[model samples]
Target: MAKKPYSNEADYVIVGAGSAGCALAGRLAEAGKQVILIEAGGPDTSIMFKRPGMITMIHSEPKLKKKFDWGYYLSPQEHVNNRRLVATRGKVMGGSGSVNGMIYVRGNKENFDSWEAEGNKGWGYADVLKSYKRMEDWQGPDSELRGKGGPIKVLENPDICDAAKTFIEAGASALGVPVNPDYNGASQDGMHVIQENTSNAIRFSSSRGYLTEQELPTLEVQQRGTVSRVVIEGSRATGVEVIEEGGQRRIVKARTEVILAAGAFGSPQILMLSGIGPAEHLRGHGIDVVADLPVGDNLHDHLFMPMTFAMDNSPHHSSAFYFGKALLKDRFKPGSNFLAHSVFEAGAFLHTSLSQSTAPDMQLFAIPWSYPPFQDDPVRLSPDKRPSLSAFSTLIRPKSRGTVRLASADPLAAPIIDPKLLSEPDDLKVLLEGVEMIRAIMADSAIAKHVKEEYEPGPGYTGDKLRAEVIKRVSTVYHPVGSVRMGVDERAVVDPELKVRGIDGLRVADASIMPTIIGGNTNAPSMMIGDMAGAIVLGTGL
Candidate 1:
């Protein structure tokens, strides 16, 4: 544990340099305000993070993931055959956005409107549109809804394999789901190729896009800086106590406010550590309460159950040797490199027959490569064998809620993350229907031409058998939010303006503040919150 002199203050002190923190810090600094961004992880040095092909290797390869990943495993899930799933959260500068699959999803317009309807004013689709438009530099074919000339490069991968083409077409002809070229556009009902946070086959993360250009004298970013707790004076949050590399402690003050942008799990854990959670829970940890609130409650996330099918000859190949040769020469056109995009290039959304919800409750996406079965329930995956297309039946709007509680009083100890997945019966029902829909899509004549075999939940699987397979196979899609929820209710962590309910000069600006989890990828929404929250805190518009 070496030591270095740390800055004592800034106008705004933002903890966790994740999606929200980057957008907030960048916007505040750009507004001519002094800002300090702190992150627990080290620098973004891995070349794997720069290349899309190698990013998922972080999920598979242990050595590559060790540097930035928190590696937190959850408690055993009772609904999912009592299996404990590993939690994958990035501890890097850009937070999860640094290591996450860079699929850019703005979520549905109704998703934000639902937030406002839940007593959070000004978070409606129309109101929050400016923040997203302000942050995205859309490179794809755009209309008035899309934004241009923003910092984060939002580009659709121009290159698509013949297999992906068939997947999109089958969604329209077979499943009755329309072929929407852009899901982020007017309607989110149909299947379309996903846009990614990339430019010229290079990853565009919050750390790279937002913080990289903020070399201004006012903005200071500290890496390997773990925030122990928010220093509260009476009922107001004044600053944060940070532990730098090698056991050094520093108090970084915030003149305006202390913003907590540490994601869903981390934010609640920090709040509980700071003695700002449920009263009885705080006393049990032997810490004096600051502002007792439901900091770690209302935790929910998206879960996906993958079904793979052996396909006929596909027009795609995973040749790492040839890719390496091309990478060495640095030859790739912007948005034209297949290696830069995740294999989950195409996706579809639908409202299940069982559910009466207007918005699509189920999301479907395809991965070209055959991934190993989840926890070995006999999905018959061949990762290196013949070509297989895997489609994930995902539950975006989940009814099951969970919690993030402190395992101990120690700031360094990882918190107990129990998503309590599949705890609700409706969740299981929706997922079952989703699987049924995906099977129908595979059975369609247009898609059936490519299918060689049904891997899991095939002919014999019905009723109890299919239900058992779903519980065994369903796993998180890595989008966790709503731990530190925002609302006007008594249990709400923050208000509409994102102010901590029981504390002054404190706010939370991240995915944690979402009242309900959005119906799609959360990375884009998280950054949008950062941008909008920064403006609200500064009392200005972008």
Candidate 2:
């Protein structure tokens, strides 16, 4: 196979084709500028993309390697459960959003406000709110807070089971937590139905939303293309070197800019492969230095420990039930799940310590049933099961940070992902408090009626023993950020405008630019970043 060259130079060469890349490509191409969108994975027009909770089926499909997943795994974590967990990123056009849980959460206002406080001008809640509204087409009652006429569909899942609803109401009432209708509203301090990225029983990934109605005369989307290096010339990113399907390598030049949206892991890997990482790390790999900024330092992700309680009632909490209903061609056809079933999905933000910042240090996601363990084979629990309600505690504002270093200057080689989870003793203390809080919620009379026993770590486990067990079973909640932090400081990789520091014609737009992790799920915030990045790149908004 011969390598293909860019016959015509595009105004914008967007790499990765993930959430941010899709938005950027759509917007830039719509603006009448030539754009080339390259994706490591293939297109996301598969049947599996429509199933709501079919993450397992999607992951198991062998086509994922060729289509929409990078399928990267982390190096061992000394602090975590001593296992190298799988980190599945979409190799498809829509990126990870195509394969993620599809829960749409915008985090808290304080999270964005903190960016402004850190000298990142025009990134506060007030500025990003418009971008959020601009990107979403919400289903429920729209107000000043939610959007009604955007590409992405944000709707509440109506097919949530009766047990799930009872679980939320009972659990929140017992714990004195308010029943908040919208977490994305004025405050993010209550429980409510989870908002999802579904429209008519299909997954509405960035690719679908951004490119559906747009007509781009000069936009070309290439899938099954792997980026090997960012081509820099005289401190300017001019283009990229990539390997196509049959392993043919080519260098495609960009006339204007090369925007990297390869996500937290892929972006850093490309930067390092292009000799634009930490000085010593680059030299160690025998790669000549470019800008030598911290490309992969300050890595962070949301760490979660699942607290499971066996419910007394035999609640219908099975994936079989959900998917079976979807497969059956009864009166309950497509989209009926959203109209009928009511699964209670709610989040709570709390301060582990009174002296902490305004944002909630601990974030909780209450689910009606227990799914299989993270990265487990078969991707389903055994048929012998029980009714359970799980409260997952995520260390929202972690103090400890990690790094993503190259394995051997090889883009194909997996990056060294050391999140340094629980490196700070304070993190453990807060997590411990979260564990206690979940226990208290389950113990409450209203919630207790649904519970039969504690399954994980078992009953009669308390004090340091329980604490140790919590650490033993904890896993990542899939919210990785800050590997390429944004700021005006010397250590920062990108500036407030998301432009790479000390470099021109290059910018990073993804979760990688977050200076710190937000208080809740990162999907909505990441999309917000994509929206803001599009506006910034187009010079349309502040």
Candidate 3:
């Protein structure tokens, strides 16, 4: 598994060493094909990346912007508070998974089936189930729904707080939603324990899980290299132009194909920078248009509104305290009681509106303690401070589509990300229902005894009051997808095989290609796309 130098040519050139990039690189290399992976960020070497609860520490670190984070900000949306939301992307090898909450959600099966219905061939639930199974290594009991041996480790913890347990019971009872043992099992519409990407109390990022030391020889990962644009010849990508350490620009040709696994933002940006996006927009930036396909026109993301509560009893479930103490303990005694640092204990997926034909459109992440926004600071909540619970409701399958357009002609300039959340009135209706649902779950008698007061929106706030509050606080979960959507349509950026609609030797293998966002987290699905892309590149899928 010796590291190999980047040669002048490779069978495949994969951009961005993020979740999908890592998976694609490993899989392509495993097929005995030479692959070169370029990443803008440096290597993932932070101690916080290995610790389960150290996500807070990583978010707070000043070096986050320089090391593992792209630190992009979204344009102000007029629909919400007109407040600009901060979008953090991974700059490191593992990408956002290294900085994320590490939740291993596969989303609802029906979500994929819907893609098939929308003319995206070979992307139905059945087709993706195999990919999911291929990537997972479940630590819990084996079942038809769970995978036993795979790259990513998915596990559940039994040390969750009593508040979390009671919330599940009471919340389900109040809403008549059944309790499900596994969200990935029989059904996705119920309260259940969350499955996390943790292995023995350590965060298992895709870089560590898929590209282990044993697989390095097959994969040549190049870090600290900023990709400028895709090298295209006669509307077909053949290589990439990158800026090396000393600001030296070099072109590396690909013998077979060029794959863009650079996540949602990076993927679409790269395509547009290479003159392969909407002709009108590219022309506005003074760039020559190659294909004029709609590369960044169909952006979508999960918008979340945080519903909070104020409690009256001291609890040991605070995420901040757990992570801080875990870090200190790791410095003193490594591998001693690692379970104490796990962040998410339990979660649920539900249909905010029962009448909708769609599956669960909202997901609830139940945290037993309170922390600052993004959990980016030390535990400031005193031990004597009352414990609280929060239900972060995200609109999973949003119909409102936006775009990522070039802010300038410069390839190094960041793209303008306009998610346009809640542009459709129905989306707002679903969000309002989500807020009401959270209230209903909290009001359940099984856990009502611990409730003290409503912290957000207040008790008197109802109807339009609550709706207004929702619009005021709603923000993105950073799960933007579909900018370079894949489908069998004339306007689609990529075809069913993930090849750019009107181009050859180029494909997008990231969240950007998803015709729509899944019912839950995008990290797992992104990696699965990467795996599928690797197979497609090797001519296995064809």
Error of 3 at 327 (Å): 2.1
Using lDDT as the measure, name the better of candidate 1 and candidate 3. 1
Q: lDDT by residue for model 2 over 8-117, one digit each (tens)?
A: 35788888777778877887887888888888887677656655555655665565444456656677767766667666677777888777778788878888888889
Top candidate (TM-score): 1
Worst 10 residues of 2 by lDDT: 375-384
lDDT of 2 at 166: 63
lDDT of 3 by residue, 291-324 (tens): 8888888898888777667654325445455556
Best by lDDT: 1
- After superposition, candidate 1 runs with Cα above 4 Å error: 1-4, 315-337, 375-384, 456-459
Q: What is the clash count for each candidate, in the order shown?
A: 1, 16, 0
lDDT of 1 by residue, 351-407 (tens): 886556667888888777665567432122235445777778889999999999999
Per-model TM-score, in order, reads 0.94, 0.92, 0.93
Better of 2 and 3 by lDDT: 3
List the candidate 2 regions with Cα displacement exceeding 4 Å.
Answer: 1-8, 60-68, 312-332, 337-344, 373-384
Q: Can you list the residue pairs that collide in candidate 1?
A: 1-246
Which residue pairs clash within candidate 3?
none
- TM-score-superior candidate, 1 or 3: 1
